[model samples]
Target: MTAGNVVLGLCSYTHDSAAALLVDNVLVGFAEEERLTGDKHTAAFPERAVNWLLDTAGVDPHSVGLVAYNFDGRRYLDALAATEMYAGRDTTRDRAQPRAESFRKVHDRFGSRMADLRDRFRRARVVPVLHHRAHGLYSFASSSYDAAAVLVVDSLGEVQTTTLGSGRRLAGGGCRTTIVEDIADPASLGYAYGAVTEHLGWRRGDEEGTVMALAALGDPTRFRALLREAIPITDGGFSLDPRWFPLRVLAHDYPRVSAGFIAATCPARDPSAQVEAVHADLAAALQERTEQVMVHLARRVRSVTGLRLLCLGGGVAANCVAVGKIVEAGIFDEVHVPPAAGDSGTAIGAALAASLDNTRHLATGVTGRCYLGPAYPRLVLAENPRPGLTAHRPAAPAKHVAMKLAEGHTVGVFSGNLEAGPRALGNRSILASPLLPDVVERLNDTVKFREPFRPFAPVVLASAMADYFTLPQPAPYMSIASGVTDLTRERIPAIVHVNGTARVQTVTADANPFLTEVLTEFAALTGHPVLINTSLNVKGKPICGTPDMALDCLTESGLDALMLEGWWVSKC
Candidate 1:
């Protein structure tokens, strides 16, 4: 089939459904379905996201020659069968409805539904890419490095859980990836982390970050031995002991695995119970073991591939603490993780596969930033002003917002395009002074309604990054965690985690002039250029994508004001 200039990528029928549109290898639009639907981590079809991408890019459906879906159900079922055989599981089942039959039924239904959606693009040829391969491609292709060792560790992608590969740009044009290793399903670092999250009375995939936060507060000395027995590092990869964890069964059933593991190892607590020492210790052990295993895998990848640069993808790459440890270990000269490293990012990967030949224009080899979602028009404030709120267009919106932030007031700053990934990088963020320690507690209680243990991130001026955090380079995506200097920690106590490290976003004037202006004004006011920057959304909700959603967040939360583009809207 002849391919067109525009390629549409869709990731759906799984968590964090998203869509991406690449026009002649340039990513013009991308968005997660949850942001538009107001559904958190929704697995539904990303029709709205696809529509928005097409509409925003002004690309006709017929121009989309390739429609790439991130999952291949047939391959997934085949992998499942292989996993069962590899694990020596029973293959016999009820004649009427076997386990494989159930999977096949769902696969057929989903494929049919997807085909129906493909009717919109009459000339497009739809294709499905392997899950982990998509992740690897996105990581390596979006990176600035010409060659790198790619590692993808996730709960499960088809039958594979982890993939180690190498990617390099071809001499002529485009890029190629070669898979060097694969860790099959049931023995996954992502599943292990999710299990630990569930045992700690948190949602599996959604609350792994909470577990990572709690781990810093506990001593893992006592629990490490037990966790090590469950997840042991092997020669090339790691293995989950079936006795300690029924990996095959646990992979499919979330509740049963968490319940069984807790019943056997620790006492199950109430859903709302405060995190106790035991919970913290368990989280600490899981985190420590996971980090060790990841380092082992990364070192192996580096040795095998002889590559200095490392690019990581999959859900496990979202673990900033683990990624930090890997970076600090010096296993790789440089480590790069995309802004959206999880499942949602696979959409970008699938699109890139079809658009690789045309990406020669991206000479820098690096994908720019996370600000690829829809942006609200500045004139919208004047067109549709909400009641009980007054909007004023200041001569310098950044300075006005910075002044509010200097006054210890939490302000929602919604400007430009929304961020594509989980972390908010100033565009759609809530800003506050990081010097006030009480601000963390207030933001948690009133604004975020999240666990206090989860620390806020800091946006620092790029020039001043070395003065604050011990980082090798600028982390524009907030993908790496670095330790704050003692003096810097003293200056900004609220942004420091219990471990004295922070997920820092370094902002440059050229890349983010608006945020840089705000930081400049803030530095004039407080003698520091750092401010607390968190996503502008409440707990269990996706980040605000539109002006109305931003206003709603400001109205519902305890924020003092909201900066929409050049206009400032304050509470009545």
Candidate 2:
């Protein structure tokens, strides 16, 4: 944990592009490009993100010695090659591109922007970490566990669909991740679910969570057998039948489904069409299959690795329902999923991987994580004050915010450093009283401007989770859903879903003292230590990253109040 040159990590040119910086084996800063660009899930190179991290950490680019990229450039070309084979085209068609065509592809000589890193900073060495390897490293380095079975399931990562690995701490405070088994492409459960998402009439990557929520309203048994047949279970994982998910027709720009799928089930839904009961049933069936396969995969990893702890990452791990099922199955003694489990998190993973290689130890993990982004040490209102809003500083902002929430007001809170991933995590979140009636309805329809079917989660005090939700452990990142107690269901109807489960986020004082105090004060006033929590942004937009953006959202959305740093603001 002592010495390493400054390392920069990049996960760009794909979904959720981001950058992370490590200095002396410690991750000092990380940010997703989508948060700064105003475009949701932009794949642009994260130049601004890297600059911001370097500036925030006060690190000079000239001093950086290594650059870690989250994808083996050659292996990724192989992944792209499968796309050609899947499309039934000659794999050699794009192998030898002309100089100009190849110029667009290469950023440096070592593969994938290594030259660019050197050009931008100095002559830093660029290393291409395998995509799934970065994910496994991130899980192992970030968790408190010394040894764990790691599972990474995503759409595809350099030909790997699902990876089963084991990670253990080395003698010198370092960690090692070893792949025990992996399921490669052509039989991807991630693609199977993505195909199902597109067929359900929603955007594949952007709207899978909506499908997860819609599943709560449907009957899983209606189409369970059909999907089970389409995706047969294997020894450790599952495989998607080529008949149901023809590679030529799967995950492409158009014709999202195969002819066999149309013959076996109905055609893909139109985007503007209604969410009919059949669609709901299909989503439920798909979700059930995903949960079963994930649980099966975790169980197999536990068996093969003989490890009591599990660390899960990748885009598919973002499914809270499936994650909860894995935990409920008790396949391991503990399960840890990073806050940013998706592609954006690869930046951190890549950096940690390099740090382990550079210094033989991971210096940052097990504590002080997820809130490593930019912060407003000063209130943002005074910089670019928005009209029609009255603001004042309060000595006890948490107490004052709790008072407003107790009065059934929807308040948007923006404080501390930004949470690194998709989940808002209280630092950038909207809060509402869960005991109030129609709070969820108004939050969905008016405040968030989202589908009514979408559900809100409860941010409860950590010690109070057992009193409300039937969770076996603390859910610090809102990554898992658990059963709501009978008393909780009756009292906080706003947070309870149709399936009688709530995605609960348990808060501790160290994570966010103000939110913890607010929840504590709200409990003192309302007798319930819970509030409806969701991202502090409208649908189809990334969460606000700057004070100006937060102020704009405060004016545009139907929120009743605002917590701008330590000040409370409301529309005049």
Q: What is the C-alpha RMSD of each candidate to the true structure, in Å?
A: 3.0, 3.7
In order, the Cα lDDT scores of the candidates are: 0.82, 0.81
Which candidate number has the best TM-score?
Answer: 1
Please write out the lDDT profile of model 2 over residues 260-305, one tens digit for every residue. 6777666778988888888898889999999999999999999899
Poorly placed runs, candidate 2 (over 4 Å): 1-4, 77-112, 248-251, 365-368
How much is 190 displaced in model 1, in angstroms?
Answer: 0.8
Candidate 1 lDDT by residue in tens digits, 60-152: 677788888787766646634543444354322211133345456656766785686578677887877788878998888778778999999
Instruction: Compute the lDDT for candidate 2.
Output: 0.81
Cα displacement (Å) at residue 482, model 2:
0.7
lDDT of 1: 0.82
Which pairs of residues collide in candidate 1? none
Q: What would the TM-score be for candidate 1 when compared with the true structure?
A: 0.93
